[model samples]
Target: MSPKNYEIIEHSRGWNGYFKLDVYRLRHDTFEGGKSAILDREVLERGHAVAVLPYDPVRDEVVLIEQFRPGAISVQKTYPDMPLWLNEIVAGIIEDGEKPQDVAHRETLEESGCTIIGDLEYISRYYVTPGCSSETVTLYYGRVDSTNIGGIHGVVDEGEDIRVYKVSAEECFAMLQNGQLCNATATIAVQWLMLNRDRIRKETSALRP
Candidate 1:
């Protein structure tokens, strides 16, 4: 049994800001009949994004941004009757011609009001929701100093109302355990940090020579 090959015959734009129609001819081989079959499929044009999990080893805190999510509102009636807002890590869509690392740094500052001063550690890149959406997100980890972070931050033009919270790693873990934090990105990042907690602490503690 060999892999199937697809050939695109035609494509067109869709209503949701992506390619809608795609005519594909697939080639496959059958062992029993020794025959070939053709199939068709369509794909959507998706965009890329970036997410940053900013950690402050000195304070043992991770920065989280809180904002109201419309999607949450639409689905809140299913369970946990409450507001549709959420607390998540600093993240944003990668603008055209912007590097992923740069976008991570930019979104960190925009959402957390703190500057990242350490090396940007690449974590993992993943599809946000593969079932219906075509959005890929690159994740990164960076050390930041939250010593003087106190103020409202977020893009005004984009109608972003973000509140920054500097909570200890222990508290973040507690939130995860208590069901207070349910965002996927935040959960993934925090779990990663939990796994590498010792190494991150040691690396951040080593003095520059």
Candidate 2:
């Protein structure tokens, strides 16, 4: 295996709004044991985010939310089959001095009207597109009672029009297979839950009220 190495030479900030953009100039060691010329790369600086899959041990269901995404709209221009309304787990940007699990709990309530009880089990952390964006998401699975979790939720001031849905684990998998839940965070969380759901349920069973 080849050694991985890179040195950042410059990071010039461009835009600063909902998300920031920066241009980098740097170089790295080539596979041939040589240094390549300095290269300029533009990166979207979307800070770290947190996502959680709210699961009900008793009902064996997961809570998901549907909302419009402008990013999906841009993709739809090139791929018409892509959906503008995305189905995703509860997610939000992590604020300074806040832990990922805290964001998961807060977002769950604001986005799905569901309360995440018990300790949140960390699933994984991943970058959305390291090649062009500096966005990484920490994913988790939190215990919740999904029996009556379906409803319209989300903070109105933030322009969030989220519709919550509580579906069985099987249904969530089906949605993923059929392209309904194609977002990265939700897809990863659902797949992880599918693999460890039984153990998660058993461990959290005592914590549920």
Q: Name the candidate that leads on lDDT.
A: 2
TM-score of each: 0.83, 0.93
Reference-based lDDT, residue 122, model 1: 88
Deviation (Å) of 1 in candidate 1: 7.8
How far residue 38's Cα lies from its native spot in candidate 1, in Å, is: 8.4
List ranges where model 2 is wrong by over 4 Å. Answer: 1-4, 205-209
Backbone collisions counted per model: 0, 0
For model 1, the superposed segments whose C-alpha errors exceed 4 Å read 1-4, 16-46, 80-83
- Tens digits of per-residue lDDT, candidate 1, 1-209, equal 56454444444443554334333454555655444665555545457889898888878888888898987875777875655778788999887899998898899988888788868998899888774556788999988987777567899999999988778899989988886677788888888998997898888778645
Q: Report the lDDT tens digits of candidate 2 across residue range 81-177.
A: 9988999999999999998888988998999998887688888999899999989999888888887778799999999999998889999999999
- Model 2 global lDDT (CA atoms, 0 to 1): 0.89
Q: What are the per-model C-alpha RMSD values against the true structure?
A: 3.5, 1.7
Measured with C-alpha atoms, the lDDT of residue 130 in candidate 2 is 97
